[model samples]
Target: MDTYKNVVRILDEVLSLEGRSASFSRDTALLGAIAELDSMAVVSLITALEEQLGISIGDDEIDGDTFATVGALVDFVDAKLKD
Candidate 1:
C-alpha cells in the first residue's frame, strides 16, 4: 500500500478532499475529524485500498479503531502486507 503516501492518496481521492490530506502526518486524526469520512466513504476507502494494494480485508478484521488516525490505517495496511 506504500504505507503513508498511498493511504493519504486513497483518503484524499475517496473523501474528495482535494489535497488536504497531503499535509497529514502519521498523527493526523481521521474518522470524526474529517467530515467527508462517513460510513460510505469508509467502505469505499477500504475497497480502494484492497484493490490498489492487492490486499484482502476480512469482514471480521475491521473496527472503528482502525480508522482512528493516519498512522493507524497505515499500520493496518502494513500488517496486511506483512501477512
Candidate 2:
C-alpha cells in the first residue's frame, strides 16, 4: 500500500475508527475530535508508525499538528522517511 493508504489503515486500527478513515482527506480534522485518540493512542500510533515504516520519531517531534489530520501525519511520516 502507498503511504496514504498505510496511514489510513493505521488510523483505522489505532483509533478504532470502524474503517471511517478511508473517507478522510487532507483537510479532515483529527486530534481533539477523535474520541479514541487519547494520550495512550497517540503513543501507540507513534510506535506503530515507526515500526511499520522503519523510521524513528523523536519525543520532541510530536505536536498537535502531527496528529491534526491524516494528511498531516502522513506528511510527517513521509518527511521522516525521506531523511
Indicate the residue-level lDDT of 24 in model 1.
Answer: 94
Which candidate's TM-score is highest?
Answer: 1
What are the per-residue Cα lDDT tens digits for candidate 1 across 8-82?
A: 999999999999998999999999999999999999999999999889999899999999999999999999988
Candidate 2, 41-75: lDDT as tens digits: 99999989989889999999989989898789889
TM-score of 1: 0.96
In order of appearance, the predictions have TM-scores of 0.96, 0.92
Runs in model 2 with CA error above 4 Å?
none
Task: Give candidate 1's total backbone clashes.
Answer: 0
- Clash list (residue pairs), candidate 2: none
RMSD of each: 1.0, 1.1
